[model samples]
Target: MTSTATHLTLNRTGDKQPISGFGLWKVPKESAADTVVNVLKAGYRLLDNAADYGNEKEVGDGIVRAIKEGVVKREEIFVTSKLWNTNHAKEHVRPAFERTLKDLQCDYLDLYLIHFPISLKYVDPAVRYPPEWYYDGKGPNCTLENITIRETWEAMEELVDSGLVKNIGISNFNAALIQDLLKYARIKPAVLQIEHHPYLVQQDLIDYVQKNDIAVTGYSSFGAQSYIELGVDHAIKCPPLVQHDVITAISKKHNVTPAQVLLRWATQRNIAVIPKSNNPERLASNRDVFSFNLSADEIKSISALENGHRFNDPGFFFDIPIYA
Candidate 1:
């Protein structure tokens, strides 16, 4: 309950989060509960789900029908989810986080990541729930589980000591595995989630995890449009940050919408963006990206369209480079 002006204060549970949310990746578990009740009636109080996005029980039946039609208020919706890569075993991380908190009809979980510092082989959600990257799901081959990110960050610090997870993070991690997961993290990882846009601007791994207070979140902010909708020939030969010509000339000098100038160049650098859209007017213009403010030379000409490019690579579909 601390970070209000559009939120993002998390580091040991001063939880606030929603710096522009709503991304249940490739949303289409039969229209994911009416696209999570149309992005929570187009206001989106942070959703960002996973369990490898096989649609967590239709995004928890659209957050229980947008909280029985009051349209919000499951504690004002800040939910987030993850923990896949075959549940990175230390006794399969609390039964894959209680089967993603019983498929997201959550009793508690404001955030919970660890979705991929890669650790496969352990498929049995009754034989493949979201055991995605193949151990035997008929793949180009993948099965590598020696499990030790300090035994899955001490079982995600025992789901923040079993209050059923208020926070616990890491996703497609870097910065030397978050500096070797903060030298054996007991709980120090409130958020990191990457694959950020502007063609992979790792900005020194987002300035070394915001110089250690963590909280970063950026997912495919609209680069290669969700891996060119998964046909992924290097995301169909890259170059489509909403049709980049310096992001449509700074989205035509800020009238907005080169996907809101690549989500206001990563929320004008405070980072946090979720960016999904099943098009209810581009899902309220991708959560109205904090109503604009991108200067500093248009966020350095869109972070100078940095080309280190990365379209959610699992080493290009299971060759397992894990960012080499």
Candidate 2:
């Protein structure tokens, strides 16, 4: 399926990125590369990944296979990876980035992001790769790194200067935090990736970032599906968006599946979506979202589904409760 996917431009550089793509989170390492190759053949251009995801090497292999088989060129794919919490120390930043670059088999990334606002204590590379999520509470094996967001952002800015990453962005940031970041940022964040879906619309945040020219990308587009797998109590209790009557009705009206309705809802609002799938049917269905138009009434109906529900909060990791 060749795609005519919509794209959003970066704030300072004007780089246009596909509004929808295959998310590489939680993919099994053994099959990730093959899955990526298949997704590319099915028409996705954006490959959203992270170092914490622990599958960069497999993803890199898949990308290489696609190019080798004449499926797509490296320049045609927009690859994104994130710096993990443990790499928050300014000194650890470059080495951490270098590891990811080597794993992804790329000279530079299309976009690199601070995976979260909080920074954990850095563990020696000889000890462990991710160094566990130890920032919220002091553990015997890990301690607070005491690195501030400003220091981290400053280091990330230098990555741009070094041409290691073409664009830089933030993930999981709230409104006030973004405002604070913009105050001292040398280069405005090119994108804001967040957990966005009908259950957690975050419209105001989206509007604010887009107003400032930072494109927003949504993860967990299927509402509680991702969280449910993680055994999150709240997510397990919440109803799945795919089964919601409003979504199903809209899907029926459009002659598409409920999942497609959800993806279309995000894209229709100009927010990029990175929905992960290993199923061939879903891979094709997800990329084919741009073909149809959702009515203004339908879009509004889905927007009304927002309940301020967030499933990926990291407050549990810290003693100071980050999400107040």
Candidate 3:
């Protein structure tokens, strides 16, 4: 599997980043090293990860193995990781970044992201690494840290200046938050990562980011397939994108899998996708998406599937309105 699409430029830094990448979320730590190696061998140039994933060590090991075997060089690949919510304090940011660097066994990351707009209570690094979300017990004992997005973004800019991360971006941020960030950001965010799929197109947000020259990366492109596994009722009720008849017909017309058709839909629109799979066949199929093209009609069909569905809302995890 391969892509004809090359790199997307950052609005602020003009850095070139690979358009398609591999998502490392929900990958079991035990199999993560091998899965990453498989992705690299399959010709994937970008590896998307985060401290919250808890598999950076295995991801690093896989990269090392691939390099040692002459499969790919260090600079040949793009690596991205995020700062977890627990490390949002002005002082805790660098320590968290250092640990990610140490775990990934890399000197510098191609891209680093603020994992979420909200911050959680900080935990001492001496006590735990990638500290749990709640500083106390679950349920009624939960609390949020007194930190601002401005403070976190400021710290992220420092990472770029320190040469620890080449570019900085934001994930799971809404339009209002991004507008506010643009007001005082010394280093503009280069990319915006969010949950996007046929069921949840987010056309307005995509337009806003692109208008600002920030690239968009869509996660959970299969829509309900991912969140349904978590027993999300809304996700469970919606038909899976891969199983939708419109997507199936398009796949049949193009002689590709439903997954490929879905990915091509995003890529054709100039949005990047980070689809994850442990199977070697699926991994290869994902990379092959760029081979086919989706017609304007086909694109419309997919877009029409949108019904304002959203999965993976932080509000579901917290009692308060985290997104608001």
* C-alpha lDDT values of all predictions: 0.83, 0.87, 0.87
Candidate 3 colliding pairs: none
Error of 2 at 56 (Å): 0.6
**Tens-digit per-residue lDDT, 1-324, candidate 2:** 112349987887888889988999989999999999999999999999998888999999998899999999999999999999889888989999989899899989999999988787776656766455753334633355678889999999999999989999999888999999899999889999999999899888888998999999999999889888777888999889999999999999999989999998888888899999878898889888877888888888898998888888766434435568
Clashing pairs in 2: 136-317, 136-318, 136-319
Report RMSD for candidate 3. 2.3
Ranking by TM-score: 3, 2, 1
Error of 1 at 321 (Å): 29
Candidate number achieving the greatest TM-score relative to the actual structure:
3
TM-score of 1: 0.32
Reference-based TM-score of each model: 0.32, 0.95, 0.96
User: Candidate 3, residues 197-236: lDDT per residue as tens digits?
Assistant: 8888989999999999999888988888778888888988
Candidate 2 TM-score over all chains jointly: 0.95
lDDT of 1 at 97: 88
Model 2 spans > 4 angstroms off: 1-5, 135-142, 317-320
Candidate 2: worst-modelled 10 consecutive residues by lDDT: 135-144
lDDT score at residue 4, model 1, on the 0-100 scale:
19
